[model samples]
Target: MSDELTAKLDRIPDPKTGKGLQAAGRLDGVAVRNGVATIVLKVEPDEAIDRLKADIESAAREVDEVDRVQIITTLQRPAGGGRDKAAPRQASAAAPRPARQIIAVAAGKGGVGKSTVAANLAAALAKAGQRVAVLDADIHGPSIPRLFGLRDIKGLRKTDTGIEPADAHGVRVVSMGFLTKPGQPVVWRGPMIQGAIQQFLNETYWGDPDVLIIDMPPGTGDAQLAIAQTVSIDGAVIACTPQDLALDDARKAIAMFEKTHTPILGLIENMSVFLCPHCGEPSEIFGHGGTRAEAEAIGVPFLGEIPLTIELRERSDTGRPVAFDDGPVADAFARAAMAMLDSAREARKPAPEIVFSS
Candidate 1:
């Protein structure tokens, strides 16, 4: 009976990785007595136990000779527990918490490719094997769904615990665009917008993702205030063109985050210059270095600059992100993502240790 139980345990697979549960070290003790089998297991602290329990039960039942199967689980230090110990405990406080990092991509005004940057950065992180999700909080014009080729997808539905997000390009996506019909304008008042934003954060089931990118609306408004009050935002990335007009609004956006106590991760200068595809020449179409100067003046990091390119506009118009293709633009966004991660790491506050006596 022990032999049969062992074989059955070998067949079960880990829910996250889809490998054998035994191979993943999910199963531990295996004992059998009088045609009954009992198994002990360890579970991931961040994962739901219902699924793990079901997997163990189904695997034990596979043994034809076993009359009954019993399972028990206790939280154990994961394999190579040193790494888990090194991670910030504040970042891992509880289950169903906000993402490990919440990055708000905001702009002083619209049309600076803020949404485009948010979508591409999320995709680039996903491509780099990081679990990512994008939340389009630009209630007036949610463009992330369109950017990820998910314009036709419907809004997420409420599950037993929370809302289940739609999947796109291996990244979970939730947006106001998914909720409203295409071409329909969101003409709701500030209170309505605030309610919607609150629902998206509180009701949505954003699984345990490494990063959650929020595409905020153009200006600092009541909707943005609602988001600030709702989530524990890790940091923010302000987007602006190099033009003076946009920089004026960009400063306000930065101030808003600072006033709300959200760390300013960095500033991204989009459309700083126009790069010619044929000649490989750069033109200062929107002027130059204004955003860098602003970053220096404000004492915030300047993440990077993105050149205005035809491919960027065309790809966004066609519902495919430029980051999906290999080029200078993709490289720029990749670097920006790394910079954001670095900034978040630097800003992380150590978790308070809990001491207990035996």
Candidate 2:
């Protein structure tokens, strides 16, 4: 089925080279599942992206088994070796920085609840009267849309200006989840991931916000490198558990940011304790203070600790983050949000340069 879909895409002509999309290297990926055909295309700035998308969608729908066609586009690098230079495409062509502070919420490994931390932080920032936007960079596991209770949003609004993100809880969000259907997996390579990040940064119409919280995919791999190299990330907030295993990965995350020259905003100790709802007593389920101690050892600021409460879990599951409501968990997240803002401001300060006689 996938091969048939690819064949259909190959027949679509690319106006630039007057060749097929596959021959021109424009068809990035093709997949067929449950009668739905998904096509990912690499489009250049000068190309008629909408026209090409429409053409592909129309062509794919001709297949008897394909009941629906979904098309996704990524920013294609200019021909003749332009990947390195492509990082600044958005900064040079797009309006300007989408927000004053572009902070990446990252973790060294998966299952660390990084997306939950990012969602609450964005909510807390918005609650504090700052305009916030979230970019879910975890293309394979995009949870921001569900975290914000935006699963109903099927697609983004594409205008002559750019793609408009979905709004929720007074915060704007952009995620790969919004493009693909539920339960659909994103099977892409490094270059494809890089292109998607570039497109989200450059082509999205994110009205000037105070902060853009990027929920990065776990690990120090291609996605992380793509984000670090593509734009001037003001700072990165590392999320880790209280266990030694999680801390080990967190250290690697910090090291990656340092190596990339992106500032370490701070570290967050998530699931620090479990507060029993019935007894109102605190239990160090994951063992407490490990992250704080690790932060002290590494000389990085320890933002704060987020407790594991029944309420916190319920709110997150229901798409209503605890950060918006007044509670202990909300207070903790607020404190972290403020600390992140401070770190971002400090990061923006220009380093003092010394001049010497030569």
Off by over 4 Å in 1: 1-95, 350-358
- TM-score for each prediction? 0.70, 0.88
Best by TM-score: 2
**Clashing residue pairs in candidate 2 (N, C-alpha, C atoms within 3 angstroms):** none
Tens digit of per-residue lDDT, candidate 2, span 297-317 = 988789999999988888888
Report the C-alpha lDDT of model 1 over 1-358, residue by residue, as the tens digit.
6667777777777777787777777765676655555676666565687866786778777777666665545345566656422122232344355588899999988888899989988988987889999889998888988788887786567789787888887889888888666786766555556556766776678888999999999998877776775677899999989989999999989888877888999999998789998897999998999999999998989999988898988888887788777898988988988998998888786877999999
**Residue 272 in model 2: lDDT:** 92
The lDDT of model 1 is 0.80
